[model samples]
Target: MRAGWWSLVATLLTLPLAARGASAQTSGYLDVDGAWVAPWEGAPNHGRALSIAPAIRRDWQRYSLSSEGAATLADPSHYYVQNLVTATRRSREWRRINFESGLLAGGLAYRGEGFRTIGAEKVPIARELFQLQARGRADVALDKWGFSLTATGGENFGGAVRQPWGVEAGMTRELGRVLLYATARADRFREYDTVLVHDVATLDSYALSATGGRAEEYRTVQPLLTMTGGGTVAMGRAELTTEFGVQQGRRMIDPARPRARKAWTELIASLAATYRIAPRILLRIGGGLYPTDYVRQLPQGKFVSVGLRLERGRRQQVDWYLPPDLPAFRIDTLPGGARAVRLRAPRALKVDISADFTDWTPVPMRRLKGGDWEAVLPIAPGTYRVSVRVDGSEWSAPPGLVGVLDEFNGEVGLVVIR
Candidate 1:
């Protein structure tokens, strides 16, 4: 089973790289990292390994297709492989609001100590896990504040998480270089057999105990709340970002001992610095300690990694950058794979934006509390000509962007999305 899964994942992963040069609208990237991972839920041995991830993406007017894969090897006998494909479609933007839906299909295979067992002899075995999910989302974004809600349903085969469903809603506020967000999520599902996660371990602890044991199937309703604050600083050719957040949730894992319901709280903190070493190359280093992922059954893993990300394309990246607090046209990736094109218009009474991808229709920007204007578009990876007007000004490009000429003999800014 493991061999078959590896073969399938390899084939699926290679398709994207093979189609790299097939179209200008398609691009791919590769990330290689080396890290030291600590224990979780009372793991005995620590792990040090290298992980490689590669993905390719193709974009159209309102639809996007992407395939991504990752391989991690702690030892010759211990390894994991994951590959997935997703296709998303966006409805036409109307009045600063857009709806998107997508379907995802993927599978993963792994082998480790006590991963699986069979028969009374309790022989260790390997298993393959498959997933299929359908999700829909609605986003309403303005100049300064944005809100999003998503509903998802999925089934997992060959895993404890069987048929599952959930809803997540989030709100974001823009504060210059800092972005603050809060999310509330509720999930109702049944786990055939779940790992007991009550006894947690410190990420820096070396001496750990074994408390992991199997439990019977139980129906659970878990509601989680998370709050995050992040800030970014630009330093020459390098950008540093710091994020801190907290998660609080209650898990009803044991129905027999209902009163023993364990409530958990965890901290989420991470710092990453990316330096543009070359036009198509970036050097990144980051580290963080995170708790278990209840949905995926991933243990509490902590690591520090240094990696290089390579962007495969012929276009030379523009070297100019605008300050986060300045009035600039920019694209910001929100949670849940949604992207918003934002413009800072501090004193404008009104703002309008047009792009070739939008069929050249001027969409009015939604104003935020502190003079930020934004609009969501279903644009894919490629070069686009964009023009914006603020407060009834002339049609011109946003500040600090590479200027170009449109076919109408008008000035516009060339924006490259990768």
Candidate 2:
């Protein structure tokens, strides 16, 4: 099943240059995290869990493809792994609203021990299952006020996987360097029809209602509300980020497993901070406290993580532009047979230029008093291709130049060096 998917990803990564006459970029990262979940609500299996995740992503002109895999190690001697791949298409903003949609496919596997009904007695049985899943999401953003909405749904095939559907809406406000944001989400899951219910009271009630019914399928719903606000401040060689959030939700536990209640109310307050120790490495510490469901044994909802991120090329900047300050490009010829390149971006940190003439290495342009940028390069009269990086953002062809695909599978603007 995965062989075909990997092949599809390869084809998609290459087709942007072949079909669209443009270029693209491929990037990825690897991360490892460890945490200890103290015993909560007298749960049997509670201990340290280590997780490793790796991902690869490719970006084209208006679409992108990404693949990620994750594995978890638990103290109870169980194995769980998952792989997900997604493709997305982005649409240009109409007025102040932007839209995007994504399609995803994935697989999950779990190995554990469980009780199986045999004759009249339950016996321990090895539980190993694999599941395939496909999902889709649609997101909408109102650029004027930083409001967004998203909806997603997915189905699982094989084993005891649950079909999930969810929706989220959020908003963000930026005042100076401080950012405030909040989100509200609701998710619903439908379990497989073959799973047996282990909740004695719920099972008895179901049997009484159906006159001879055996529990087959179960449904769980969760509605959560969360709000967080934080900002990143540059402190000398490192950057410091702090955030606090409050979450309240109702989680319907798996009916196939015996639990305290059919649905439990969850309320937690969380605080997290991160310090960038270096350009590519960071240190993170976070913890949560249960206000309503706090138990003496699970005092620490704590975690610490160290992350290292590497990239091959320049980083993309936030695509934020006020209505009147969009970036544009222009070119002019000088008396000394030099080509003068100009870019108009009233609100930009820096603008850099790169072309085949420059060996594809970026060189900064001088910012003019008029809030634009200009760079004069000596070149013979000929046609050349050039790409610009605005404020260390993604490589893009400036407006007014002919768009052509680059060797990296992305688009660049064609310029006349004459």
Candidate 3:
């Protein structure tokens, strides 16, 4: 329903900011995407759209909450909105195994003025659906594997009433800077009157609104089966992600009729790239082919998309220190009222430092020769807690700097900036 969708999305977008004062770890992001789409087979349904997705995650003592929302508006008045909020209760680890259970609430809606035309082609578009599910998850650190099960029920996926029941299991492993994952899933689906799958490449939010029919529903005994594999590689300022999947499912051969069943198979592949423009700014681009949407009763299509995202994870973070005209193991006053801090450990491979000012997030130092590190930074002419780790080892204070106990009962080095 367009009723409270925008208000809900506004709440989700501002939730992280509202939780900043809490003792929880809170982060959020906002994405703005511009999309263009064309029907995979038909003459043409080419159109332009704008989409926005706001997401937030909060982690507290023994629980966590994740909320995501989206809204899209297309040319000639096509609109869609979606929301998913999940709250999980974390369990105490038992012998290398961790467990979690949560409830999920997801909903979406879309509508356009009955018929929109491009050239001489007119297409109908109206979609909306809602669902709720309970999920249980288990993760084992021994092999870096995670399994999850969900019992779900929803309304208006394809028919008058949504077919319930869906389950998915996945595992992930990290190798160096690359992460690999695989998943298998099965879900029941059905459709009723209108085919709401609409256009895939139009706006991602459109797909999220998959709902069918006003009268009867299409249903079969078999569930949709899918298998997927994906990987992500992180490079300095850039990252690449890829996914490949195969889906086998049954649905109404013709979306209009509440008829028997038809089996279909499809291949899914996509690539996405992201570049960090700044601590809180990012640029992203992605596209690929899609499979049939049973909920909206729409056929499969291809897509390409580009977007910009603003992340809260690294907000207000400090930059890596830079080399300056300062001596190692000493401090010097630099131009522009800045102070230079230097290290002279020539045998160390790499050096990093953190201070109270940097929120204790380590900032790398410019290395010369073997391990001589130096960086220029600005700080008030006062004393502050500092710590250094060489080659990313345990934090410790070097000679000539005061050593004291920190809030965590750990040792920290003291640096005086003049």
Candidate 4:
């Protein structure tokens, strides 16, 4: 099966030059690559396999589309295709609204002999089997903060056919080099036992329902931090990056089991370095490890993966789009002698304002004429460091300071909300 899949891919790549001429006018690029996985401690022992994939992308002034198809060679053939489309409109400043959707399809094939023996009796064998799956996602975004929902369903007809479906919602935010995200998901599956049991009149069928099995549903929240720095050093071209991530979740299992509920957590840390080998290529090396723990079960094992990526592109650009109408800041004195400061920015920006020693959360600031922004917060009548951010980008104050830390290039200002 693997050989057959590779043959087909070779044929496609060897097509006449004239056959490829039709894509000359397309704006997107094409990527083709393959990977080989070695047997691991707990993974299946498939010697090796090859895969081929082709992708295309096109972007217009306000719309973009991308599609790709992949075929993998193994004992059982695996194939899939993914397509996505998005439309976006930029309002004023850097505020923009976007709508996106995508689809995915795939299947598995199994071809093997099945034989059985029962108390000095031998039984003959029969046919093959496989599984199919389909999934989709839709989302809307306002600048850095966006909302996404997804659904997936799959069925296995070969062995004790069963079906499963699930849905999920997620939110993402960026703060300078730090990213915060959280997701809640619920899914249900039909359970079937393939092994035969003696004197068992009937087999039990378990159906996970959306409302009944809250324990079966799982939710995860993850927050990550990444730092990047690079410049010429004494020995040679030098670059460094560090990242840290943590995740926690709760999971459900068979109700018949005494301990059917479980919780899990994971942590990851990584560091990388790069040295210039040439103008077009660089020598890169990196390593990272992830550790996870689960309740009632033997703690899950950890693994580390290290690889390099060669990149070729023009110099990067920092583009900041600020709407023509910026939010206004208002100050008011309360009867109790407390001061109030308010700022109103675009709803999409998810603007958050805070001073030293105060936690920032979402607040409704009234909209004013001319796209003006306003916010009110009582301060102790002293100078304080004020900070504002939309999505992950910090608003730049006068003097071109990006943010609180110059190293982070975030936005910060010294304002007395009093």
Q: Each prediction's Cα lDDT score?
A: 0.66, 0.54, 0.64, 0.39
TM-score of 4: 0.37
Cα lDDT tens digits for candidate 3, 89-169 = 989989877788888777777665444221123456555666666777777754334444444454444223366567777
Once fitted onto the true fold, the runs of candidate 4 whose alpha carbons sit more than 4 angstroms away are 1-97, 107-144, 154-162, 198-302, 308-418
lDDT of 1 by residue, 302-359 (tens): 6788999876532222112334555466887777656698876543556788888789
Name the best candidate (by TM-score).
3
TM-score pick, better of 1 and 3: 3
Worst 10 residues of 1 by lDDT: 115-124
lDDT of 4 by residue, 101-219 (tens): 33332222223222222222232222222334565566666665657676766664543235656677776654433334556555555433222222133323233222332223222
Question: Which ranges in model 1 have alpha carbons more than 4 Å from their true place?
Answer: 1-24, 41-44, 113-127, 175-181, 194-227, 252-260, 314-418
Cα lDDT of model 2 by residue, 181-262, tens digit = 6677666554332433345565522211223345465443334454455555433223345655555554333344423223
lDDT of 4: 0.39
Which stretches of model 2 miss by more than 4 angstroms? 1-22, 42-49, 74-79, 110-144, 158-161, 192-263, 268-302, 312-314, 317-418
Return the TM-score for each candidate structure: 0.64, 0.59, 0.66, 0.37
Winner by lDDT between candidate 4 and candidate 3:
3
Candidate 2 or 1, higher lDDT: 1
